[model samples]
Target: MIDRSLFENTETAFELKSDSELERAYFLFKMISSEPLVRIGTAATNFALKAHLPVEKLIRATVFDHFCGGVNEDDCLPVIDKLYTKGVSSVLDYSVEGKSVENQFDNALAKILKIINFCDEREAMPIVVFKPTGFGRFLLYQKKTEGVVLTSEEEAEWGRIVGRFDAVCKLAKEKDVEVLIDGEESWMQDAADDLVEEMMRRYNKDVAVVYNTLQLYRWDRLDYLKQLHKRAKADGFKIGMKIVRGAYMEKERERALDKGYDSPICENKKATDDNFDETLNYILQNLKDISVFIGTHNELSCYLAMDLMKTHNISKEDNRIWFGQLFGMSDHISFNLAAQGYNVAKYIPFGPVKDVMPYLIRRAEENTSVSGQTSRELSLLKTERKRRKL
Candidate 1:
């Protein structure tokens, strides 16, 4: 087992103050802890925003600070530099969600291309990330999977999605930056998988320029990973896989029930955890053909990967194995891993306050829901505050 002292040292490094910032974080924690209010209010706020209400200021002050890098790429530079100074790398994510317009899709694609270009210019920014839904309508993605032929307009939208991905991958290849495509809802996943497979086939021959995110919480993903490995081996290319425990559990379960289909989600958290660790072991064993980014906050999972690395005599700087957490959560895991000479990056999302509200709310809600995570953070902050005698 990894020593508990590692976490203690990691928490101390943050040097948190017991001032207004800590107080605000506590308040938000309490608010999100109120399960009834969080459920009702999150739903209501999502609805209100869809109805075009003005709540950007509130979002920016609270959850945005806790999750997003900033409002745009330029806005993210200082934060990226700060992480670089701390020996942590940044994966730049443009956090816009749930759009259906062609122009909006095209704009998102253009912005992602620009981000790729920016990362190319900045050596510190090693990974450029995107969600396919950001560049294509969710409904269109669903329809495409259902064997529905697209109309001319829909075909044009599909072209835009392809164009966006191609542009990002081309820039990433040129700049030698890895592009990490995020996982999405099960219904929309087929389209994402198809697109990512195409990109991998085209650009992953030399190095892993494109990565497909696999959410291990899905019951079928382990097998899917194996199949992808087979395809990559047969095609004579490296496969880059970013593994997460998934984020859309509740939504997926509800949708599965509503649509009268079996849920694709793992039966419980333990099952998911088991699958995740097993998948990590598989990837480590197949390190020659696969590059893996272990995007997790679980300490055991992190150590499990480390243990596999040691057993296999894999170098800490292999570049094929990486560890990542989101920007605000799991600093102990991310910073400590990096400090210990492992490749670690934080998933730093940035966008307009209004556009990133969903992402922020998810972070807030996740902190409150992930067993002891919020309490652990609060306790650490308080301990650091007391240590500073504030």
Candidate 2:
């Protein structure tokens, strides 16, 4: 269990700001903790067209303020500086999703390349990330796995996708920054994995500059990691992988049941947790051949990785392993790990407010659905509130 007092102690290693920040944080916590508020807010925005409501303003004021850096890159600098001062780094993610039109895809490609260029110019940005679904149609990615070849126009569009990824990878390699390709739904993941593998082969000959995300909630991801490792060894290049319990578990399970197929998710949470830790151990053991980012909010899993690092006599600054959590949800973990001299970063998402509502809703739903996490946050806030005697 994480020590609640660690966060309560303002002078502790993680460095909470003056009482003012904590007070503001507490107010935000109270808002998110209200089930009725979250339910109505989610419903209003989710069915806004039918509901004919303008709830984006409320969303922008509450959850957006809590979770996102801002709606774009320039707006994220203050948040980046705040985290950096506390010893954490930031991963820049341009969060535009679900684009299908070729020109729109091309424009997103340019925007991402620009973000990478900006990162190249900044000292604080260590990683640049993008979701494949952000750059292409989901159905097209699904089609690739079915052995359905694309038409001439589709092939040209596909080339543009490859070109965009290549541009990002090449710039990352040149700038010595890491590029993390976010994982997508399972139906579209095979194409993403293939694209990442190709980039890793091309750019990872000397160092790991390209990483593919692995969603371990999928029952087969452990073996997939092993296979990726084998391929990396055969190709004589270091493998880069980011491991998570997964972001789409509920959707994946529901889809599987609806389609009469076995769910790819682990049979139980214990299995998922076990597999996540086991995979961490596997990557640690092969640290020379693989670089891993342990992207999880689970405390035990985080500690297990830390303990393993110590057992192996690995330096806290070892570039091969990093610890990351999303921007707002796990500041306690991210900041505390950074204070301990570990390589840690927050995944900072930036985009227009309207464009990123889906991301925002998913975050709210995640916190609300995860048993006890909100309660824990509430408990921490109340503890701190008591500490301050407010």
Candidate 3:
């Protein structure tokens, strides 16, 4: 039985950061907590880059440095070492988005292989993560999901995409590293899911080497989980999944409204939360055949997981369950969970400054949109700052 107040210890959570780092985080969160400021800042940053102004260095030092590991694999070694010192695992995510060429796709696959090899040696990096859109054309995947038959050229292009995915999973199997395929916008998710299921069917026979992310904000994901579980169980394989509230809510609703179809997302925060918890319960009940990754920032959801674990008599250090939060946010949850002997990991994204800008922008928008997320983080940082007399 773990104490409920375990996450209240801010000192241990912020111990790795210096006084200056904490101060910078406080100021950054304060600026982004306001929706209007985040809106203006994003627009200004985009404009500055377009107008050939010198903003990359400033962004690199501020948000990029705060949120990302570095611009490359070698740059992430030190960050990995630092997190390992605190008993937290790192998932190195090659977070460059908006590329669809075959060359770029191959390059992404190669870098991911490098990451798998890097983790092959380091225990701190237990999982590798990359989104399907990073290596596949979003439009092509969307059309495929819509049941459109591709022409010969497009078919060849998709063949290359599948070939790249096969290489990643094949190497992951050999290297003994888990690869998490991130979820994307609903329009293209069906194609991604189909491909990911194929990967899991091929690679997850003995172990959960490949994971598919499920967004609980969707209205049908709870049922989807049950059906997937049935398939996995019958097929004699384990299923790996990362559960989240999702990232593309605004765009999802807008697109559904534009297309004259019902929105796939939940109706409200309560509905999302309820479905998420129920899904967690369902997964927990089948822990022997399923590996679940809880990727959330909500403290209540975290507690619910803990209670579920206790009820199911699952050990805290069970490798089948992992708690993940993004780097530079939710330190209290990440660090405290690690301290409690739980299998905890942090998502550390790395790439070139320009390539990673989209991820950084999403982080800013998430802080602004998620109710009181930035404010709660700021409060914890302020408390730790005051405690240290910084």
The 0-to-1 C-alpha lDDT of every candidate, in the order given, reads 0.84, 0.81, 0.91
Give candidate 2's error at residue 99 in angstroms: 1.9
Candidate 3 residue lDDT tens string, 91-165? 998888888688888889889988999999988988998899878799999999999999999999999889889
In candidate 3 the C-alpha lDDT for residue 86 amounts to: 87
Compared with the true structure, model 2 gives a TM-score of 0.92
Model 2 C-alpha RMSD vs. true structure (Å) is 2.6
Could you estimate the TM-score for every candidate? 0.92, 0.92, 0.97
Model 2 ranges off by over 4 Å: 1-21, 34-36, 46-58
Look at candidate 2 and tell me the lDDT of residue 309.
91
Clashes of 3: 0
Winner of 1 and 3 under TM-score: 3
lDDT tens digits by residue: candidate 2, 1-390: 333443334334225545665666667666666778878877877787346577767767766766788888889989888888878888977776767787887788787777778788777788888888777888878888666888998887778788888988998898888988888799889988898899999999988999999898888988988998898888888899999988898899899999999998999989998889999999999999989988998878888888899888889999999999987666667777887789999988878777887787777777777777777766666665676675
Question: Least accurate stretch of 10 residues (summed lDDT) in model 3?
Answer: 1-10
Candidate 1 achieves a global lDDT of 0.84
